[model samples]
Target: MIALPFLKSVAPPLQGKRIYLRPPTLSDYRAWASLRAESREFLAPWEPLWAVDDLERGAFRHRIRHYDDEAAAGTAHPFFLFRNTDQRLLGGITLGNIRRGVGQNGMIGYWIGAPFAGQGFMHEALSLLIPYAFTKVRLHRLEAACIPSNERSIRLLEKAGFQREGLLRSYLKINGMWQDHLLFALIEDDARAGK
Candidate 1:
């Protein structure tokens, strides 16, 4: 396992008032696929184009394996957000492209099931995740990018204390098309200031 230089010990599951985040497992395929299938239309606009077998169990298993590999390499941390009350899978979050040494930073991305949208679940999950990234993961900065039309995501990022940095032209491909995105960032000092 490639341990993070700043991480002296194993980190615990990130817990919040309404949700908890844990690494995805093979056993989570059924629930994950079901939620993604149900939320396909809701998520499509903000996500990458899905392959024909995206929701297949085999594909999901492969995703889990990839996540595990990334985590072990200390390049990313992928988590499934679950409701604490019922243990329902609400969404997924990833802090990817982690950089150490002089640049202690990572990029954050997330999605929520359609049924769970408009709830405060994601907010709570992010609250827990930000602190973990800053403290346990020792990230000095966390970045997020959202499509220009994604108002909800923009608001969520702002509410979580991220500052709108700039806009990137054709920054990423979403649903098979290159899309412009608004960049946002939060630094460790910003969190310390309670922003």
Candidate 2:
């Protein structure tokens, strides 16, 4: 296990009405891998192609270590969403590329399990996460980018108060192809406006 000297300074688990967000743990490998496997087809178009060992336990441990390091360094906060009632893993969200001082900004990314998609859980999770990001993480701006063809993600970001800012040409590589993406952003003021 990696030691996180700044663990206490990191944002705590966020609790919401229907879901809660916490960091991924070693014990989560089985469920995480299973869900990813089942959702592979549903998620492929929106994500980078997975490596052959992506779901292996060793990979998961490495991921956990990386997450801890990022969190400790105050560069990112990675969380796994769970249903509040049963604690079933539903999805994940990450506030990555966190920048402080003059910027006070971060990029948000997320993915939901196929079985839990379209059920308002991710929406709820975002509701909880946004507040935490602004207040607890002390972030002024949060940004997200999604493939223009991904209507679901676009809608989700809009619903979560992210305004469509613009488009990027060949912004990122997804599923082994470079793709254009729509950029969305939310500032602290925007969230305060209840957008």
Candidate 3:
């Protein structure tokens, strides 16, 4: 008989009041695709354009594969937000492009399904993810950028205790264009200090 070694996991799923963040699963496609298809108009403005066949079954499977690869490499931790009690998929959140060593930081990004928008689910998700990043992952800071025109997102970031740093000129290629962005940051101490 041959013995196999088991590998230990580094991170765990995070939970909040209304929602919990979990790794994306193959079973999520049906619910996820419905939200994306129904909210095409709502999400299009802030999101990159989807190809005509983007959400087809094959494409989504490929997307999940890519997300898995990034997660394994420590480049990102991507989660599909779900209602806590029911575990219904709400949307996705990510702590991406993580940098360790001297920086010890990562960028935050998220999008809520249209039906779940304005219900404060994203706020709940961020509340859980940020603290997890700080204490569990041992990151020093979390950073986010919002298109200047995204008033709702700005408000959400502020509610999560992220402070406006400055405007970054042509900072990111967003929705197919190089657009200016407002930088926001939240250090662990700032969150701990209740700022």
Candidate 4:
């Protein structure tokens, strides 16, 4: 198995009141695979179609390499959420598609295992991540897009202080189809004002 902590020295783990966020590691394959397999039906609607080997160990290694490459390139940050008390993986969140220079922005995407849904974990994780995006990453703006039918995601982003901007027709290919998404955004100043 691959070792742990390739990202520790780079970004380190972020801790909140009830949970923490850290970069995924090779040692996480089994738990990650198991949770994703079990939650496949629950998560598939909002995500890209999975490859035939999506949960296999080799695919996991490729996934890690992709994440590591993005981290190195400053294009994305992917974190897995773990409960503080038990360290159980509950979900994952990503601040990706980053643009610096004049843009100074990043996009957010996330998912929670079906078993852990509606437990306040994502709320806390979003709380932790917004600050990380604004302060630690020094990003000027963060954005999230969700299918209009994804009421839960809409609520989560709004509760985290994201303001709806507009809708993009066929913005992302989800579940193998081009789907419309409502766009939301939060700026650094807005984040500070909300605090």
Candidate 5:
């Protein structure tokens, strides 16, 4: 069996050409809230409903604490995606529910702020992030599920080399009701071969 403590100790942070991935900080609260509030319209369809209080800095601090604990425990790695040149917070990316032993896998989740969508920053981040997950983390596979209607997200994942595995009937409760998601995955060997 793979050792959990070793994975926790060696969890890697990924940096991309345009974005740098880092652990969340309290200082990021205002920027995070501002981005979410401004992008509500753009992101609401894919995300869970947000309470009015969710936009407050205190709420964001709570979220940071949760993410920090998950990352430290090796259960997840939640990174704030930032523009490397300007250091502007663009959005967030996370690899969560990381499993070892017989699974050797993890699930990926991410979002880009409203203003930054379609700018190709996420594509760059994922391109770098996936390799780090596979090679450095030594995971056998990475998985992601996207609402079928999210054309942009589907395209982004495809561009980053994930293959469509199948559809999960009402796989997730998103934005309130159950929603179907197209499951996608990339095996480490396939990714290494540029497939």
Candidate 6:
């Protein structure tokens, strides 16, 4: 959860061959707004119900503040995906709900604009993010949960080496209704072993 006049100290970007992941800034409002608005119908089924002012500039600024606060507190990291060639915002991913000390883990959440779906951008992002989660963030486990009907996400997680754990009944609210999710996890040991 974050946005715009750009964050004062932009986080270092995680680079990939075709994409990069960096924090979203004020400069991204137009592209982000257009993409989300255009893909509203496509995203609505999977995302939480949007607020009446979800796309407003003020809301985005507030989101960025929250993101910065979380990051500074070591609780979450949020990033926007961009194309290497053009820097177009493809989507966003975040490692949230980080638990430290005895529970060194975090939850991953992501979204790709409809136009960029099925093109492997997210896979590339995860390839970069997972290692960072383990080595840089020093996390022991990474978790992801997707709506039961989101076959694309299910496949993506599996392909990224996450093992299916189980189902979470009424795990989250999506589009105004409670929905179940399939829980998946990837542990540091398995990742280091090249799983």
TM-score of each: 0.95, 0.94, 0.91, 0.94, 0.93, 0.94
Off by over 4 Å in 1: 1-11
lDDT of 5 by residue, 1-195 (tens): 766543563345577877888877899888888888889889989987887799887788888888878877777878889998899999998888888789989999999999899999889878877887876667899999999999999999998899999999988888988999999999999898998
lDDT computed for candidate 3: 0.86
How much is 17 displaced in model 6, in angstroms? 0.4
lDDT of 2 by residue, 1-195 (tens): 875443343568889988999998899999999999999999999999999999899999999999988988889999999988899998899989988779989999999999999998888988988998887787899999999989999999999999999999999999999999999999999899897
List the pairs of residues colliding in candidate 3: none
Q: Relative to the true structure, how large is the alpha-carbon lDDT of every model?
A: 0.90, 0.90, 0.86, 0.90, 0.85, 0.90
Q: Is candidate 3 or candidate 6 better by lDDT?
A: 6
lDDT digits (tens) for residues 79-163 of candidate 4: 9999999999998999899888799899999999999998889999999889988777878999999999999999888988999
Candidate 6 lDDT by residue in tens digits, 149-176: 8999999999999999999999999999
Candidate 3 residue spans exceeding 4 A from truth: 1-11
For model 1, residues 1-195, the per-residue Cα lDDT tens digits are: 764466432336888888999988899989999999999999999999999999998899889888878887777888899999999999999889988879989999999999999898888888989998998888999999999899999999999999999999999999999999999999999998998
RMSD in Å for all candidates: 1.9, 3.2, 3.9, 4.7, 2.1, 4.9
Give the C-alpha miss distance for residue 3 in model 6, angstroms.
Answer: 27
Model 6: lDDT of residue 58:
90
In lDDT terms, how accurate is model 6? 0.90
After superposition, the stretches of candidate 4 with alpha carbons farther than 4 Å from their true spots are 1-9
lDDT of 2 at 142: 96
Runs off by more than 4 Å, candidate 5: 1-6, 9-13
User: CA lDDT of 152 in candidate 3?
Assistant: 93
